[model samples]
Target: MKPSFRLLSTVAAAALVCCASSSVLAQSKFVLKLAHADSADLGTSRKAVMADTFAKEVKAKSGGRIDVQIFGAGALGGEREVVEGVKNGFIQAGLASGVMANFFPGAMVTDIPYLFPSDEVADKVMDGPFGQKLSADFNAATGMHNLCFGEVGFRHFSSGKKPIHSPKDLVGMKIRVQETPLYVTEMKALGAQPTPIAFPETYTALQTGVVDGQENPIPTLIFAKFYEVQKNVTLDGHNYGIDWFVLSDKFYKSLPPDLLKVVTDAGKVACAEERKVNRTFTANGNKTMADKGVTVYTPTAAELAEFRAAAQPPVIEFLKTKIDPKLIDSIQTAVKDADAKK
Candidate 1:
């Protein structure tokens, strides 16, 4: 028997509703919450650009199958907390810096004083075999997948009280540093008292004289407005800072092969873009800081050598107690190999 017109219309309406629901489901196969403690809206922020690029690329390439939600400016929490969230599956991904050493001690190898002489060498070492091995080890140890290594550029000293031109300048100053042993050891060796302060608290610390100065990349000095509080910026380039694009292992496993490839590929693309942006900012950093009424001092080659001499030995000895000496040797070898390449 043929159905009546009204009955046929009702069946068609039901089919349309079912199709719409399925379409909605397909549009968002995964909802990824990526968080960081930086300005997402800031056009010049490398951290912000990194997160934004990853979100944009993943959404476009995934065809909306992956929904990326970015919470910047510590909307979620500090780097450590955000990384913890990623590890626990509360946050799908995050960009973590020095705090990563707390989770994976091996990461401290990257913090070795005077590690990379140039961006080219740093890129080669980090994107090559050394980085791959580190990534795999980080995943195995923390159960959080490191998508890629984005850069924070080379860290420099910024002081509100005085210009830091040599190790003597830092003597007795209370410098804010990440809550890690390497930084502490480095500061002590430099004859400064290292105060372990959270990133969010750093500005106030400097303003209130809780800390005399801090060390960070030039872009970070601008982004965090550290220049406002710190008048002196010493381009010591003490440490080659790195930011990890990390993902939850559980979330990673949930992705099918195609989607997984999309996320990982997007990570590489985003990391490269971040490095480009950061290097550009760093290249012009001296002038940028000077324009802001900050004293930008480029230490002489001899002065920088003094910094390396004072900081590296203690940090290396401390590292030997905490991690495999062979790993330390390997990273040094990797840096040498990378430098020799061109």
Candidate 2:
């Protein structure tokens, strides 16, 4: 028997309604787990604030439908493990530093020493087009959504034995670095023997004299108690370390459109707050370290020039061979444009 046209149309409409209803119901049941290797107290740490803010906003925007569970201080695992877990979908998200670069070699470009002149310059470059493109590229390659970049601040040299004012001073020194090729190459180019070590184990390495010194932001030195074992802190500000907020693409794609928007918006807000907190913490850490009897050394213009002149060429040449030369040029141009605006 042939069905009437009206009857067939009616049946199709009902099926469409059923599918729409099912999708809405599924969207309402989403949840995400975010983790990081920092303590929950945000007193002076921006990363902590970012993690907390993201969780709160996601819940509020999704009307508590999309629950975001945050684990701090390596509760889930270390940075590298957390990133891997995200990729495999065991964990939904994580905030990781350069160590995560080992999985994405393009990220290594940002870690080049003396590349950024100041915090202001770093902020301008990373928040601009270049950073946005890199974030997208990382997402495409790793199947992880790159939300926004958080700050780890500029890394400086701190040693127990000597004050580092120029490249010559670092000669033959065994300096601790993250397990990134760029860091190892940078340190080697500057005449220091690079020693790769995990962040959580750095203080012990310094204390036990397993390594002569290490480089990290002032706030990190204070937070991790590196100042206790290292007497001299040099404000060389050699490299800019950025923290990446990476989320599982599989999990994100499963979310409803509305919930996905909420997650992205929340990440943007959290990134801004985290930047402010990091900057303030860095400023205050200097004074805190001084009060704790750690000597702070600032290099003279001539001394800084010498270090820059020595490190830049080798890094530039090495990058050309490893990465697209045009990409390196674009990064340099972006940085120059950013500096000119200031």
Candidate 3:
């Protein structure tokens, strides 16, 4: 009563095909959420635009194996809250700013005023070995991954008072600063009464005279409508404000090898694209602010040097207490190397 060999072969082949189709149906897909502090519709918000780029790139690169859900305008929470969510696996990713120092004190390296000579240099270093090393250390310390540095462009001074020409002008002025000790120290060193204020509260703080001035990159100043409340904006480019895209160690490691590669690749592409957006907005942002009646000041070389000289030394000393000098030396070396190519 044995079956024919051809019949047996056909039955086995059908069973194998069924199993293969079932396996395909049962394969797991990943869903990741990215949180940031601005509205998705805010064209000038680099984080928002960057999240869009990352989401599209990751989805395309993963071939529907991954889905990125973006919660902007602090829908998930503030920068610190979002970072904490990433750290604890409550959220998968976030766009975090200097507040990252809360978890990795070494992040203070980014806070040094006048750090990166140019956006190009910052990109070269942050995407290179030094940034990778720092990012690795951050991952090891806090169970989170710093995917890459996205741009916040260069910070400039703006005031309801007069235009800022030198540190002396900042003296006695009450300035709104990110509620971080590093910034408090830098503004104090520059002679402003550094008033730590929440980012959401800043515009109202300015309007009410709770603070006379604030500092942020050009596009931010304009989009945040600081231009409406402030008359003079200085173009000192005092600091290159580097923002980070972070992922949870748990979520990142959970990805299969091929998917992990796709995510990492998407990170680099998205970061570069965000930098382009920041650069474009910043280049023409001065004119935008001027159109809003903001008096823009471009300092002479001597005037800028005065501001940088007065601002750097003490902050370098302050950073020494928080970060190793060797790491700082490493950053400067990377910058010099990046610049040497010019």
Candidate 4:
């Protein structure tokens, strides 16, 4: 039987649509949704740069076999939510911060005050054997693969009420701390009353005086615009922050050997790019703050010593009860090794 011309045309159109769908599917063999809480401004946000760079790297390396979509500025929710998503395989990847401690207590060791003497030492320790073990442990605990440790730089104290010169300056002030026991204990050891607060609510807490101050990396202070509400910044460099580039174990294992290598290698590249942008911002952040009318104070050597003496001991004691003492010793040993090599 001869079919009508209209019916033949309809069948041809349907066949074309099916072919197009198949082509699209073949081009993008894998899709990654990477999320973070940082601002969407790629020029100023290190997280954005890292995610964007990873997307490009993977696409180029795989020759269009993989697709990466980035969601910044809490697009998929805050850091915690993003971490949870990655763990459960709902989200493929995330740049997660201190919230990582909740799932892997061993990670809290990095939060020890004045842990790394300098950025060089920090890089050596975190990118060395110690980092490899930590990544493995984190993967075992959370079922998420740690691609690399991205820097959040060093955390410093900032206040609207006063300039902090030493531990005494923070005494009795209601400082906003992340909703973590280590942060609360660290602040208390420094003599400040630690008020546990969510990160998203921190700026408003500072402005409304719900909390007198907060601590974060300089780049965070600038991008989050905490400088607008807070009048003073103390470069105490209390803790060097480390954020993880995590991927869902399921998603990672599903990748072909070639694509898996591409993603892992691309992660290292993205990590380096993030650190470069972050350190540049950190080095010049004080000047930017000063121009914005914020008082930027760098403590004298003696004063910084006072901070180290006050915060490190108590935080160490607190951590001993939560994690193995041996892990803590390894970090200190690794730091010294890194310093000696330099």
Each candidate structure's TM-score, on Cα atoms with residue i matched to residue i, is 0.85, 0.88, 0.91, 0.87
Candidate closest to the true structure, highest TM-score: 3
Name the weakest run of 10 consecutive residues (lDDT summed) in model 2.
98-107
Candidate 2 structure quality by residue, lDDT tens digits, 1-342: 256888998899999999999998875787688998878787955667999988888888878888888888889988888999999998988899866666777787786668888778888888899989888888877788889888888889999988888889899999999776677878998999999998879889999999999998888888898889999999988888888999997888887788789999999888888888888898899988899899999999888888888887788788777766777777788888899899
lDDT string for model 3 (1-342, tens) is 256888999999999999999887566588899899776774767888899999999988888889899999989988889999999999998997777888898888876787777787888888899999999988888888888888878899999978888889999999998877777888988999999898879999999999999999988886788888999999888888778889998898788899888888888888888899888889778888878888889888898778778788888888898878887888879888988985
**Ranking of predictions according to TM-score:** 3, 2, 4, 1
List the candidate 4 regions with Cα displacement exceeding 4 Å: 1-28, 208-210
List candidate 1 segments past 4 Å from native.
1-28, 160-162, 197-211
Candidate 4 per-residue C-alpha lDDT over 224-271 given as tens digits, one digit per residue, 9 for 90 to 100:
899999999998889999979999998998888999999999999999
Worst 10 residues of 4 by lDDT: 1-10
Worst 10 residues of 1 by lDDT: 38-47
Clash pairs, model 1 backbone: none
Alpha-carbon local distance difference test for all models = 0.90, 0.85, 0.86, 0.91
**Whole-model lDDT, model 4:** 0.91
Task: Give the winner by lDDT: 3 or 4.
Answer: 4
Q: Write the per-residue lDDT of candidate 1 for residues 206-324, one digit (tens) a residue.
A: 99999999998887777688888999988888999889999999899989898999999999999999999888887776677878898788888899899989999999999999888
Q: Backbone clashes in each candidate structure, one number apiece?
A: 0, 0, 0, 0
Off by over 4 Å in 2: 1-23, 197-201, 208-210
